[model samples]
Target: MADKRLAIVHVAYGAVGQRQNRRSLSFYFEPRSFNSHTHGRDSANKEPWTTRYGAQQDLGYTGPLSFSHFPYTRCLEDPSQLFDIAIIGFPFDTTTSYRPGARFGPFAIRSGSRRQHARGYTLTWGTSPYDLGAGLHDCGDVPLSAYDNAKAIDQMEAAYTTLLSRPVLGGTNEAYKSQTAAISLDGKEHPRIVTLGGDHTIVIHFDAHLDTWPPSGTTGQERITHGTFFAVAAEENLMTNTSIHAGIRCKMAGIQDVEHDDAVGFQVISTDDIDDYGINNIVKKIRQRIGNSPVYLSLDIDVVDPALAPATGTPETGGWTTREVKRIIRGLSGLNFVGADIVEVAPAYDSADVTGIAAADIVHDFLTMLQLAEPPVPHKGPFSLEDLKYP
Candidate 1:
């Protein structure tokens, strides 16, 4: 009787395996044919499979990795493919003084953006960047030499200049009509760039450090590390005096750093100013300083408190909160942003991708800032009265 029971169990298992095998064979050998519906054919008689059949969409976790999963294109190599806004990566970090992992910043930031999709919308901004009429594309990273800092800097500058020279692909929306004209420099409308930085040094202004240290004593090769690139930019006339630096809390060599920062054409906004002056006032100050001149906003990851965003080459202890930084960026929406970058996110130093997420969110804000034709009107909650009593 026991032998019969075991035999019965074996037969049951064998039958189940046979059924699975048959199902697998049927799936592989099933007759397949494409009909009009399957091929995306329509009554209008347009070419079948020519248009809607090949639509490419990516889920948050799956797809070719691009900034916000924007369609990848070699716009620099092929100028014929025009775009109003382009996301380019600068994967260079030899210039960084404190840390070396920022060279992987672009990849980390892109990975963090995996959650963002074309359909995603920001309630605060009230629009999806992809829905904006402007043509947006990921232009890939500018190839740079890791061994040569000077060569890399030149490559970056040249790449930026090339992109800046391209004509803007005007958007379809009426509100977006004026942006191209307003952001035009040299009497020609140019494409806006949102760069993924390898380090904080690539920025002209903003972050914990003033980043405007003069290269007085250093050799030509040593002159242009991440710490002093802004000074080099100032010398090269790459930045205007209207630029301003916010969230500065780095240990300065002396008062000369501030003086040099001023000379390099940046007004300083210290990290503590957020506590004293308030967020609205700080935004007002930034706008007042920038004044209508084409703005290039660059945010360093170290600008945020190290506790919240610790994956940066330089981590300053006391810095602005991520919320405060986002609020400030949101407030500055109406400014003419020609380009922007979020830099210095070293994933090796990150605990649980907090820094990378912050950087990606800021980049989302950057996109919104660039696409917005006007500053977003403040939201009034249901609890707010037309005339609320304040104690």
Candidate 2:
């Protein structure tokens, strides 16, 4: 009986060894010699595939047509339409002071923002601008035909005036053709315009620089280059007296230029101020200055350090980091932001779309902050740092 049991054990062990030998031979199907480039689709197939003689090509197909694909929430085009916010692209960059190409800002920004709407919901704010009950729309770029600076400026202002109250398409309201009454939101009329830039110059009436100079050879409209739009905007009574300019790093003509800035109701904050007084204090001061008045937030891409944002025409050194600027802007939530803009994104100067991505994110934050007026959502519990890391 002992001899018979030993023979059976030996047979079982021999069978297991034969199975291991077969498993080892299986690697022959996937040779280690071939480079990835030379590896074809049939490399893993045991049976050889027949080669095709004709040229390999994919048949193209047409899809449904749409106006534009927005990175944020989108609405249908409606004339005389009142929404919480409207995105207007001002693609006229002919008036740049240092570098040109900001005319492409709106297009680049839109492209960058393509991924945002997918992740628009956030833990910090607990809601998105789309959920705030007010509607949002992307009014495509204003058809700015003028190459002349003054004519371009007039076109932008006229377009802005028309967009403020009426639809991008003509509306029925005769009174609202060039003027719009403020729409009520959160107990206040806060229908707003969020403009993508043609250049930093388009911020003319909106900031401290009225683009004034000390009488040079350039005369009349020529004098009003990109730097002087603010002066015209102020003269037109288009700007609110409580406006503020952030990230003013470039030199002015003199102290008088600054005086003119203050004279036109702008409280300027330089990138240097962020280092002097912390971001929180700067934000507090901004909130104090802006108060409950309707506000227009303008962000120039050059405001960021060139190391982080090198795509703008005017590359300034020692500027704010993207994180710092975002924190400052985010801190100003709950303020009545009636209009805003992210300007000076020249993609031709940009490498790897860094400037475009930053511009898109800034606009995303602006949109997010617009909805932060409501109460915060309760935290669910602890999440690890690794859990929140980017993909």
Candidate 3:
């Protein structure tokens, strides 16, 4: 039954929706197949996603599920049924003040990731992504049209609501319930989720899903935030359980109304904290706040110090560096990372794919981290930074 289930997974692999299907040049995520998206279709030993961590491989023995098969948007199919991770695109950039191409981010990321997603890599967590057998899905975009800001927000809210509902494909077997529903019903597990972004605002939508996390009243936890996203999520009541962002920036003046409860616990990783303790100390502080919660990490490319990733719509100057990010993520292996997304990678800004490549490598790092085993072994020091050595 398990083998049959696994085999059918390939055929069942599909995207959930289409973000930019237009004219005759439209592109939608479907079950992977040979196509132009693959930069090295003919290579005999093509390995999809890779970084210094190791080569990319799914938990099972199937070959890499290319970008062709990635970010599945066809709702009729289910990528989550097979792979555990997804490389999402959030092309919405309205809320951002800096760049507009972020609205076109999903497309650019797809273009850059074509070959990588198709191939995938293995991680140094001493495990294969395939061995754990993760699933993949391209949920298309958040459907923002004509720029009716309120309407766009509504659609975004609806999209994430559906995602968290744990929609089920056509099946009524004993485990037929959607993965999330199954977890809620039978005490089984649901797939973890990692969303890409149209902008940092997309994190607000996920609030409805993760806000009630840690089964409520669990224990200590921090809150997550960055300038605009911080305020928006705070209002939405989402950052609470995540135990992210230790400080609420002064720039976020009026926005704190988003999710402000007196007992909201967890401090925002404040500017003062960073000023006093430095990023390294802040990183450890974040981990301590969360203790052990299945995390859904969302990296707005802006988090990478402006010096590193300037192409983003919101480039905060004093953000963490690539070196700092490597240190933090390396320390974050064991926590149950449900899913992740690297939002706001606008390629139209700077030099040759600098931000795009950076974003790609970050996503690669995320996947490798996910490839770690169940009871996670402790991470001693920085991971083999070699995986990210390339562009």
**Could you tell me the TM-score of candidate 1?**
0.82
Model 1: lDDT of residue 159:
88
Per-residue alpha-carbon lDDT of candidate 1 for residues 90-195, written as tens digits (9 for 90 to 100): 8888888778788788888888888876555877777877787778888989998899887887888788888877777776654554766755646656778888
Q: What is the C-alpha lDDT profile of model 3 across 190-260, one tens digit per residue?
A: 44455555544112111111121221222222222222444445456655544564223323323343244
Please name the candidate that would achieve the greatest TM-score relative to the true structure: 1
Off by over 4 Å in 1: 1-26, 29-57, 200-204, 217-221, 385-391
Using all chains and alpha carbons, the TM-scores for the candidates as numbered come to 0.82, 0.66, 0.57
lDDT of 1 at 203: 29
Model 2 gets an lDDT of 0.62
lDDT of 1: 0.77
The list of candidate 3 runs beyond 4 A from truth reads: 1-73, 76-83, 115-131, 167-188, 201-242, 246-283, 371-391
Candidate models: Cα lDDT each? 0.77, 0.62, 0.49
